[model samples]
Target: MAHTTDETLTVLVYSDDRNTREQVRTALGRRPAADLPELDYLECATTPAVLRALEKGGVDLCVLDGEAVPVGGLGLGRQLKDEIYGCPPVLVLIGRPQDSWLAAWSRADAAISRPVDPVALAEAAATLLRSRTAGRAPATR
Candidate 1:
């Protein structure tokens, strides 16, 4: 899909830890790839906030923290997948590479292990965003 330069994609970042959210935003920057549209981020520090933001719509992608307290992103991701009429692609932040299977169980579109590798995070996010721009249907569980 060809995106206009003026177009900006909205990415929702959900993490209870402030640092995790900041890291994601910093890693993604203004745009993950030159071809994709610029990014606008919406940070949610709580599960309720994440749900509320998603309900309002307009989110192109989601970066969720799997290690978050009370309700983890993996569970939340699953909830979004099952509940949301058309949930946006979700990129889950896992604690280790081996936890990728858990990410799959959560129905996340992509998974990245923290301490946030800027290159990998950007690439994963960019790919999901591009898929969104291409109007690809969300993957089924």
Candidate 2:
């Protein structure tokens, strides 16, 4: 769908589990911050769905559940970075702090651990959204 200048940023969230996706949506609420655009989530349950969402364009940022089945978020994030031109900043949900290296390897822009803390998730997502918004080309709006 074409994004209009309605002050809402598109956030693509991928997770194999419904509960995991719900937690992410709840934590993010309507917007990560007042300074950032209000979020409109595009939920994806599979790797193919994620790819399709990204392909549709106007994705301001992505939140990926690293524990997702089959193709995990980290692996998908890497693929996205490799293949998508001007990919949006990605925030990965990790299983462990030690997996930070893996997140980096995936070329994720930011990460937070599971049992997600609402504050931390919101803050991290907001940071990425702000950064991506700032870096956007003039016609992005």
Candidate 3:
């Protein structure tokens, strides 16, 4: 992904579990690898909140939990892709690695299995940000 000095990519993380969201935030804060730059994250606990936030502000990437209540990340990801134009790239967290194909079906750009590895989460987020900067439309409409 091509990046500029002034660019601060925004990531929206959606999960029903507060602790899971915290883990993602902490990992992102660390900026594990030297290759990927630091970014800002907007956390959302519910689907409606996610929509409202996107309407109020723009985002570069989204990290969604497949197990979230009401609407799982994969389902939400697909809905966003279909309903929104130029949705940001999505990074989904499936319950297991076996569901990778399901993630693909949802049109998620990338996915990782839970429990998440800190380094993997950071890498995935960076990759999504890079993809966003590279002209890929975001998954949110």
The predictions' CA RMSDs to the true structure, in order, are 3.8, 3.7, 3.4
**Order of all candidates by TM-score, from best down to worst?**
1, 2, 3
Q: Clashing residue pairs in candidate 2, if any?
A: none
Which is the leading candidate under lDDT?
1
Clashing residue pairs in candidate 1 are none
List, residue by residue over 1-141, the lDDT tens digit for candidate 1: 566666788999999999999999999999999887788889998999998998888899999999999899999999999999879999999999999999999999999998899999999998888778686532222
The local lDDT score (0 to 100) that residue 120 gets in candidate 3 is: 91
Candidate 2 TM-score, true structure as reference: 0.91
Runs in model 3 with CA error above 4 Å? 1-6, 30-37, 135-141
Ranking, lDDT, top scorer first: 1, 2, 3
lDDT of 2 by residue, 47-88 (tens): 999888888788888999999998899999999999999899
The residue pairs that clash in candidate 3, if any, are 84-141, 87-138, 87-139, 87-140, 88-138, 88-139, 88-140
- The per-residue C-alpha lDDT of model 2 at residue 85 equals 96
The lDDT for every candidate, in the order shown, is 0.90, 0.88, 0.81
Give RMSD (Å) of candidate 1 vs. truth: 3.8
How do all models score by TM-score? 0.92, 0.91, 0.85
